[model samples]
Target: MAAVTSKVSLKLMIDTESRRVVYAEAGKDFVDFLFYIVALPVGTFIPLLNQEMVGSLGNIYDSFANLSTTYLRPNVNKDSLLSPKAYYCGATGLPLHVPNVESSRKVYRCCRNVTLDRNETCSCGATMNQESKYTVLPSANNPYSSEGDFVKGKVIYMVMDDLAVKPLSTVSIIALLNKFNVKEIGDLEEKVVDLGRDEVVKLLKASLLTKTILTDVFLSVLKEEVNCQQEVEGNF
Candidate 1:
């Protein structure tokens, strides 16, 4: 087994058989991680974490519109992506269609010819006459291409934990929490380190985590441990 550390706050113990982390340690300083985190949109950053590679930002040559829609959460009453106004397309100078809860089911005026079929591409062959009022965001040809790609200008807050190449370790994750200034009930640092692996899982489950670590990965490891124990008992 070899332990590897990076300039970033993450560290890992590599087991030659699986080439995966048997253990990990996260550092206290989050300035570097947070610097990169705020610089890109969540959609773009997710892909980078999964693929371990970056993609070029898509061309923002189209127009934007006030796409107001109901939020998916039942508790959220209403939300608006932009003002309830429409802008002309960059290429065609045509009025851009803003999507709303009602309009989502109806055919869009600008891309009317484009199919509603989810399987195929929706493109309108419009050639731009002049600069558009809207800011066009980049897009990818592959639907999943943006899994780990990074964009230069946009910023976002949340990210999926599983996308990380190696999820942060317990220590590292605690450091992250410390960085966030989560108020400790008592002896938080020492208590966390002293907990058994299973007890750690239970402790984490009981506590509310507003900012998550690699939840799926961490839970999976715990589940695997349970299964391994079962298998050993069966053999005996």
Candidate 2:
């Protein structure tokens, strides 16, 4: 099932829709958005506004993810891989942990049939996947369309240090994970990439929508330099 992101996470989206005025992360309209406020009222109108709000929120999310890439590096296979094992609460059944694999800063040498890009493909067709270092168990392999070389009672361990060697961004890998139905386990999650406040301010200032969203605070807003529909309309 595809996960539906709550429009609650989107403050900027609410403003662009012009349905409710969002002065900060909280206002009378945004009160219930916190998910933990004791006295907040859940409005009858919020879900009704969801469709338009969703489309706009996606815009902010996408632009943030794209803008983030220039500042971050892709996780990779090699010395950059983590040394300690990363664990999951319940992978196939029991608690699981990827064994301590070798950590190297060296990128994986594509000496075989696998190209640089091909090595990145997971079984699910995601090219940005981490490698499973563990042996797949026979029973687990049996349930799926098998390569027919099934090992039993084990889980495939992903190379961990792949996350550490790169400048982790809040957006890219998480987006990829969502697309591929991948889950994070252990303390090594890419949850908080922590864009320095300066970085966040810089992005909010540079982003075109952000300029529109925060125009009052930023008097001298520079426009985003991009090819847009406005160009095609101008031609007409």
Candidate 3:
């Protein structure tokens, strides 16, 4: 018995068994000793505060998100994308085709780059050469009812946003700085840090994001530049 007691005492010191036992007993005496010691009111207050916050926030009623899951809400009305009465005129680029033209038999008239050869000329001397006229008829393609003359040199506005990248609103400056580097970054790093800490984090807004889809890279760049200039002038 004496030998066993001595061996256990020795093992306690070696393995921190004595400390573990003391800690367990101490913890039971003072429930949550670690949290009380380290977190103080935070541990006790969290659940209470969370309950209070949730209770307060629960009072906020939203027409959209607040609809009871048990009570099914009626879906809002949806409008059709294309309006039937609306008509739009886009650019006239298609060629006026005159098929079955014979070189020898008939006198032909040239109109708006369209030649009325023998096949196009009616027996009544009516020239079949079509001078393409723009019209505003309800169609699947153009639904805006835009005027025919509105096709030339129009400017468009666009926006781009993402998280991993800089905010779009701030991008105007950031992009300028990153691209042109009018001012060095080392100087602005502190300002950026201050903004990160204190500001509302309104993102950089990139405008006039010209999409070069299906366009040659070089041509797109020039076209985009032109578009940008036109947009600026038009806006101003």
Candidate 4:
């Protein structure tokens, strides 16, 4: 599959005084990417981040990676565990890309319609090696099958700093502002940021590690840039 070069734009409402992102106003693309994270396999987490996770999960993954295949059953494929396929088919055009298992996986069947092993013999003695074509039927309950990811398209979503997601509304905005106790409107700045692959990866990692997902992932980088600009101005 080709790389996803597209970037999604997120309009973040940042509190200047607090130096934190209150929430992000986003579209289906951004929301879809966030939702897709939930479907990722447990084995992919440490490898995807290229760092230690919060607990002993990282150590366990490392041990599995280094373990010899000699001890395992002859039919076992190690790659199946280390880099398992993600079976979700709803998310499309995601900036945070993972290969769709449904599309890439090749299925073979015998007359009995068994799909487990390609070369295994069926009860009728027929070899299950004949490649079969299959179609993924869209769920009857899926309303946005025409053009949408996990959620419906053409709807603006509000993603909180803690990764909470909801449909955008005037009432929601007002409630958020009141919750944050924003006395001055000037302190709340709306900034549109482009999220590409790298930013998405940071988001994925931050989502797992912290409750202040947006602040921890984006705010620290923003502060560093500001600090660098100040230093440059001082030198001039």
Root-mean-square deviation of Cα positions for candidate 3 versus the true structure, in angstroms: 34.4
* lDDT tens digits by residue: candidate 1, 133-200: 33334366421111122332222222223223233345554554455454431322220122223332
Candidate 4 per-residue lDDT over residues 1-236, each given as its tens digit: 22555888888899987788999999988887777677567775667667637888888877888989888666556666776655443334354564423323356777757553465555566667888764445577743232235787899999999989999988887888888888654679887888876786778788778899898888787788889999999999
lDDT of 2: 0.27
Question: Who is ahead in lDDT, 1 or 4?
Answer: 4
Number of the top candidate by lDDT? Answer: 4
lDDT for 185 (candidate 1): 19
In model 1, which regions exceed 4 Å deviation?
1-26, 29-31, 41-43, 46-216
TM-score result, candidate 1:
0.22
Sort every candidate by TM-score, greatest first: 4, 1, 3, 2
Better lDDT candidate (1, 2): 1
The digit string of per-residue lDDT tens for model 2 on 109-156 reads 222322222245333344532332333334642332112221232222
Clashes of 2: 11
Task: Give the best candidate by TM-score.
Answer: 4
Report the lDDT tens digits of candidate 3 across residue range 19-60: 111000111111111111222212222222223333232233
- The collision pairs in model 4 are none
Point out where model 3 deviates above 4 Å. Answer: 1-126, 129-134, 138-140, 143-145, 148-169, 184-236
Q: Native-vs-model 3 lDDT?
A: 0.24
* Residue 121 in model 1: lDDT: 28
Clashes of 1: 7
